[model samples]
Target chain A: MADEAHGEGGGLSFHPMDQFEVKPLFGGYDVHWYTITNVTLWLALAILAIIGLMVLTTSKRATVPGRGQSIAELMYGFVYKMVEDVTGKDGIKYFPYIMTLFMFILCANFLGLIPMSFTTTSHIAVTAILGFGVFIAVTVLGFVKNGASFLGLFWVSSAPLPLRPVLAIIEIISYFVRPVSHSIRLAGNMMAGHAVLKVFAGFAQVAAIAPVAIIGVMAIYGLEVLVSAIQAYVFTILTCVYLKDALHPHH
Target chain B: MADNTNAAAEVAAGTQAGMPQLNVGTFDNQIFWLLVTLVVIYFVLSRVALPRIAAILAERQGTITNDIAAAEDLKAKAEAAEAAYDKALADARAEAQRIAGETKAAIQADLDVAIEKADAEIAAKAAESEKAIADIRAGAQDAVKEVAKDAAKDIVALMGGKADAKSITAAVTARMKG
Candidate 1:
């Protein structure tokens, strides 16, 4: 349809945002809550990818790990170290939870880089759930662990007494904004990069600059690959940081 | 340009004219699926993969520790063996030295006994020769005294004087003493 749309007048026509449109997989466009949609399909694929990486590859559980097993162990150690370094020994208990998020986002991001594939993480709805889930969980944990003393996270007692109130207000506002920034940062980066890729691909329709556009797409694709991995890392590390704050809210 | 407008219209119809992410219609579906995915992942990771990997790491650590301990045990055994070998060598050297000393002392005793026996035989042989020479000299002196007495009787008889036997004997004895 996009080719026919372009064939009509020999003009370039590509929808950079169309890839983000959520359509039902089973022929109807009405995306009800129970509708099996592209989101569901990609999310399922991400699950399968995780099962392959973390479950199937490690089923043998070799002490002297083979290639696939080593990769799984490397990912495990990497995220484990991140959680430990950010959250300390107390945070090691939550390692599996954090690992699940990191693996999902990482797999989804890399899968999205495929041509014509849907990027699940590029959606605000999805990332918002992840971000808000972490925020709510950490807040609940802090309260459960520290009770009303959890509010001490906002009260900057180390500062001079006169500046305490202002700093508290600022800290409270920033604390509430954590989920917003966390979710938006990932979605925005993914959406912007994919959209830029589509725009460059759209330029390939014109005969004169097609080569340059292709080269630009290649270059950006490389950058997107880097961003895909980095964004997952950033999201997971930020979660650890928030968990650390909840566990130790003094400084 | 006409096709571009049609495509744009189609997109507007599909995504509601602005960003598809802002479209409120699909939020519920995406969120629902996301929650399902997260739950599935959480269960899978927590139940199976994480524990298995942890076990494997712990097992490896145990194995390494056991190996190091075994190595240390073996090293100690080797050192003990070397020490035994050294002790054995020293003992053998000391035994050899003792044997050599005993052999030298036995040979020295035998040599000393043989030298004493040889010196005693030479002294006995010299005493026997000296006794024989003294007996020969006494026999020669008796014979000379008898001959001198005979010569003196013959001279006295030849001079036709009566010779006294006792006086001749006394004169012979005095001459011999002189």
Candidate 2:
């Protein structure tokens, strides 16, 4: 499709969405549930990256960390603090789980920044699982921990009695919209940034505007890097926030 | 495979695939792999990465705390040593001053005794000299009286009138008394 975009027109052509296509690694068009696709490869790479950063670097576990170990430790502290801050002290129990999500998203987002690399987090299906997983987990945890009182998350007791039901309806809607917004926010950010980069690169094919386009790509690439990290942070923090809501649904 | 037929057809068409993210064909693949990835990552983090990092962090904190405590201990020790040195210096100065004062007093006492002895010896010598002078005067006076008596007798003889010894003596005595 990208070739079609470039080949069809001697004029300017842009197929920014082509980069997001999921193709099989071994060249089969049939994408089964268990297909060894680019998603698998990227996901696997993300896993390897996590191991390299978190496990291998910290093998010695130096009190004074080396470079790689410092990165690993920094990431640990960053996510650990985020969880503790957003979810409170009780949230520490879920540190490893949150750390996993953070490390994966962070690694994946960065990995996607490499030229021609597949961005796993850019997909709705991928991020939805993560976001909905948090939603379901938080919901279940809330119900399990607070029982029917978990519904109190939607009921604003501080509101006037006449407006309480109305507030509940709004709160309930916002509550359900949490997963949608959480998932889409990350995916949309990644997708939009990458697509913009692609569009700029497409513009680079035009000789007169090639310099401008290249410069634009560079600038947008810088922005994409920022977006990547921020999106990961946003996702993780939102997860923590949801977890906080689950843990203490009163307010 | 059969579920993705429509998606496969769209891809076959090659240009109308629209957003690849919306492609239902790849959702299964993506979701499956995503779950797999999340599970793998979760296990790795929980079992290995996170625990190690946490341990490293805790160990670092423990080391820092201990180091701070050790530094505080050293600082306290240094301050105590300085205090001891100051105390020793003050004690030495006081001891030196006491020794100097004692020596001065001893020298002063010896000097006072010597001065008193010298004064007494000078007084004894002065008394002896006075006595010697008084003896010489008494001897001189006796001699003068003898001379007067002799001279008086000679004069009386020269005048051709012999004077008796008892009368001359009486005359001399009266003259001396006058």
Candidate 3:
């Protein structure tokens, strides 16, 4: 048992690659930097593949849409409908942004499920960046559309004057924390799920002599796939909710 | 101080024994690269892909509108043709009714003329029959008078005297006077 434990620890200690690392491309330049990660390359490849698929599927524009076209159309229509439902008639203008976000996130999440792949979304920095971008966009749009009235979102004018200040303070804090919470939520969920899967997979490798551990790994893998897709959908729906608030600044 | 140095030596040996160390500041680099990727994706979607999709949608809308317009025109034409056919049918019905009425009037007039001619022929036949009856009665009365004269002449002959016109006339006149 001790020997098996040592072997397992040795396997766990192994790092796929250590030489290729993120570094400053130019000396003393903070801007225009890049990381050499398999995840980044895979993400780019996935985006290109998805875009190509969309193009090829819809190129023919047949009356009876094929399976590929149908799937593409379904994704497009889903995002479009989601925006329409969330933001009403005026939301159609933002369909492109919402669709792009949904597609990119969905592809990124799915790509991570492949063997020997990295999930960028498991990192807090990546999620934080995306969430911050949404936060800025929504806030700017709200102010642009509603002007001074956008501040009313923090103050509950319907409430009693004595309670209004407290409510406003709470609302302001929540508003500021929106991006942080959003980023943390997705990142934490993805990271924890992947970590658990990796641990379980490790256990299965070490306990391969026991058939139950192998079954456990397979079951967990299935669950991980479900979790992967659910997390992507959750992330997209939250984005839509934020967009909704921007499009209509009213309660 | 000696134990600390020994511990530092052991850590250095462990580090050299290939305990992989992640490069510091890699997270920041990952964020930068991700942002770059996001910008490129946004640009591609906004400039190239989105415009193409919009164009295709507009073209589809145009095609549907044209189809609807053509269908409406065909429907209008069909309705007009149907109305014209209905008008022609009504006219033909009216013409048939008028012709039937004219034929009925002409047949009625011919029937009246034939009845009047039959009445005139019957009247003429009745008049001729009455004249024949009056002539037959007059001839009967003359025959009666002649029989009477013959009987008187026979009586005069029985008296054995030559009958003369004047004596016969006187005897007849005397009997008529008595």
Candidate 4:
């Protein structure tokens, strides 16, 4: 990762995109389906963080919560309320799935912010699974729960009779584009933020500009932190919205 | 995968150029680890962490409810005790008033009986004293008549003229009676 930070004149020339490199941890040229990579390590770190807070910290399960326990309970209640408010009480049965997705992405995003850490959510491969999973599950559930009437979602019966066909086409396109937008939105945000951070960090390699580059990195890092949490919230809330549509297709 | 990493290695070792994150080569490893990590986290959260947290929240709720119920019960008990005390105090005051009234009436009744008895004794004493005075008056009159008859007999003897004793007696008794 550091190799690309140097350029021709032996003076520091920055390669901002090099921090995203995927290399084998054991030093190899070939990456297989089973290669242990930096991505694996960081993904594991995110999981460990979740367990450390949710399981290890809350092991006592005191009624008067400790700090970690409080955070865990807060997160649980926050997501639970969000799901309930967005989808109503009927959508609560899927709380576990939604909660899992939220925690995973949230942990991944925040963990990725660590200096020299690989971001799992920044990859399309990771975000695609989560986004597509929600899209497919919501589609299947809508059809199963509403039967053939599920098609009413795209029909827009409220529109004028003359405009109904055109409106349905537009709705259908938007419906199909849900997964693509969902996945790319998260990936793009994470990728863009981290790439910007790298660019600023690379600028610090020059002795004269090092101080300004570090300050810029710090300011952007703060914004990225906010973005990380907001993105997770966006993803979870969108999931709830899709669920609401499935359960109440007419609305 | 082989070509992508080969290019990355070549860049790191030789001429530096390539964004390995876009290399599509390590997608397999990243995806596999992601699945493993997410699956484990989901299980832990759903089965272990979430339940424990839920239990704690429920326990706190239950504890608060129980505390409130206990407070309510204690408040009721205190109120009942105060009411009982007030009732007892009222009853005691009423009993005291009744006893005072009964005692006053009893003392009054005893005084009335004593006054009646005293009045009757005074009347009896007066009647006896009056009878004694009347008897004394009669006795005194008889004695005076006897003395006057003796004096008259002595005067007649001294003068050498004799008077009848029965007449003297009759005269003296008549005068005293008048």
Candidate 5:
């Protein structure tokens, strides 16, 4: 598809963005609400991967964990410790939500790195839901925990009184922009990395530059692996940070 | 050249699909699956995976705590045992000293009694020797007085003077008595 979209003449060309296109799994251009597309397939695969890695493998519940169990336990401790450190001990109750979000994004992102995989995290729709979910959850939690005083999150009493309104306005805008920025950061990073990989791969079609293109693709592929894992960590830690702000808004 | 033109036209058609990710129609599909999958994952994590892992951690913590407690118990027991051993050793040492003191006192008491007995016997013997010496001096003096009376009578007879036996005896007796 990359070549088909990029090549015009008998010369070599590449369309890096074509790899991000979500198409229906069946032979249909119309992706209806209930249509099973490549996104749906990959989403299912990610879920299956989650079940296999976390549930099925960890069911043994050994005190001394085996390999699969250790991975599951390590991920569990990682997210658990992160939320605790970021949001304090009281933040432990929300650990399941944070762990779920991390595992989903991490699983999806890593699954996308396969030779012919679709990066689910590279989509706005997916990351937007996660980001907006965090925004809405933390907002509601702040209100519920702090009552109407949750608006104090925007009011900076430390600043001069005359400048409070201006600061509050700025705070409100930034607060609303959080989900947008959060979602875009993840989607943009994942999409850009994969697109770059596709471009390098397309360049491999050139006889004179095949070796250079292959090396570049290899190098970028390694970097994307790191990026994929790091983005998941960043997203999860940011969620904990927001949760902290909600739980302890005065701080 | 005609084939290349057709190929370019086909490329234009492909581009007409226009970034399928931006297609709003696919938003519903992805969001729906995302919600479903996320919900399932949350349940699995909260209800299944997380609990098991937490149980493992808690179990390990419990085991470690119990082990430490048992170790402390054993340490205390060892200390108590050591204290008892030290106390027993001290008591035994005290008992040995007490026995040695009693034995030394008994020996000293026996020696004191034997010395007292020997002193009394020597005192009795010294008094008997002094009484014997007094008796010998008295007897020697009486014998010498009797001899002097006999010698006085013999010299009187040798001078041819008349000597009365009764008078001599009386005089000699008187002198010796005095």
Candidate 6:
């Protein structure tokens, strides 16, 4: 039995990317990707669901709004309030971006928790992609809004001239590292939490003690749910903070 | 069955051969994919969704402003009506007081005239009664005088034709005594 187990494990062991396969389609003119394709599909589905809900609720548009409309309005109001509180009136321009991020991340995280569903966020590559995109966009916005003054964000003339260069270099390095850190923070958390769950589930499968294994699996599952939501929130808030930096570029 | 065991053994040998070659270097691929996902999300939000939200907010703000303007107009009209009502009430009160004053003055004047007329009538009646009493007294006095003359003539005729004054006097004195 131990030999058979070893054989099975060896067969299953492969590079993480091996799970994602690219296949030729349309007579080799197009390629169909696997993991990233799945992620996009899920994201599209979530957007459709949200839009459908909004349309269903808002069709009537009553003065004394009904329950569905009220619920939809409440969600809209909540997102609006959050953006206003964090970014003020100027932040109103970015409401859709922030709200979309929140909703997408929330849906993705929740969907991953369902039985037999793929967690796109469980891959570090996916998280890094999201982080890098935000980084590029924010940098572009900064330059666009502030012009040449955006470069001043690094030196921060409040410091003495002698120390300014050193501070600037450090700030530049930190800025460059933002995407790396942001992506890793989310991906690392999700990967570690899920890996721990997988390991525990493996233990439950093989362990002789039923009660201990059951408790272990239950505790890990509960923690995973909380971690998933928390990771989504952290990712969203960081995005907002980065956007704020771009808009102001001074502080 | 012997061939199946052989196939299983071959698969186990193949797995064993691959076991020591485990390479845990997929971090770059993960990072690359994560960057892709982030880019897509950012694009969708910035390009498509944000403009719609901004338009909705602006529309809502316009609605609120219009509502406030309407409310303000209504309030102004209400205040104008309140002022008109107050003015009407004050004018009515003033007119009532004026009428009351006129009526009271007219009644007082009428009372004064009535009292004056009554006093004049009473004085005239007293004077007329005094004149009537004086006339009656004069008539009585004249009648008494005439009667006295007639009585004197009668006394003289009753006396003798050629009697002397002393005898006539003594006969009168005796008649008076009888």
DockQ, per model, reads: 0.33, 0.37, 0.10, 0.32, 0.30, 0.06
Superior candidate under TM-score, 5 versus 6: 5
Clash pairs (backbone) in predicted model 4: none
The digit string of per-residue lDDT tens for model 2 on A1-251 reads 54456557667767688678888889757788898988999999999999998899999988889999999888988988899889999999998888888888999999999998999999999999999999999999999999999999989998889999999999999999999999999999999999999988988998899999999999999999999999889889989999999999998
Per-residue CA lDDT of model 1 for B62-93, tens digit only, reads 99999999999999999999999999999999
The pairs that clash in candidate 5 are none
Local accuracy of candidate 6 as per-residue lDDT tens digits, A1-251: 23343346643321222222221222221222333344455545555555554445655555556786666666567677776766668878877766766766666676666654556676655666678878998899999999999888897788888999999999999999999999888767766665565555555555476568678878977988998878877887788778878887785
Q: What CAPRI grade goes to candidate 5?
A: acceptable
- Per-candidate TM equals 0.79, 0.80, 0.63, 0.76, 0.73, 0.58
TM-score of chain B of 3: 0.45
Which ranges in model 3 have alpha carbons more than 4 Å from their true place?
A1-35, A61-65, A88-93, A140-148, A206-226, A247-250, B1-24, B79-178
Residue B161 miss distance in model 3 (angstroms) = 54
lDDT of 1 at A124: 95
Instruction: Give the higher-TM-score candidate: 2 or 4.
Output: 2
DockQ, candidate 5, vs. native dimer: 0.30
**Candidate 4 per-residue C-alpha lDDT over A1-251 given as tens digits, one digit per residue, 9 for 90 to 100:** 44444534266555555556666789865667788888888888888899987898889888888998889999999999999999999999899889999999999999989988888898888898889989999999999999999989988888889999999999999999998899889999998899899878877888799899999999999999999999999999999999999998884
Candidate topping TM-score: 2
| Candidate 3 residue-wise lDDT, A1-251, digit = tens | 22233446764432222212222333332322353555467558666856775566777775456887667666776777788887789878877777767777777777766765676676676788889988999899998998988888888888999999999999999999999998888777766665555555556555554476567667867887887778777777788888778777668
Best of the candidates, DockQ: 2
The digit string of per-residue lDDT tens for model 2 on B1-178 reads: 4325644655663424568888887888899988888899999999988878888889999999999999999999999999999999999999999999999999999988988888888889888988988898788766766777788899999998898878887788778768
Candidate 4 DockQ vs. native: 0.32
Model 3 Cα shift for residue A47 (angstroms): 2.3
Residues B74-108, model 3: lDDT tens digits: 99999999999999999999999999999998988
Sorted by DockQ (best first), the order is 2, 1, 4, 5, 3, 6
lDDT of each: 0.91, 0.88, 0.68, 0.85, 0.87, 0.63
Indicate the fraction of true inter-chain contacts that candidate 4 also forms. 0.74
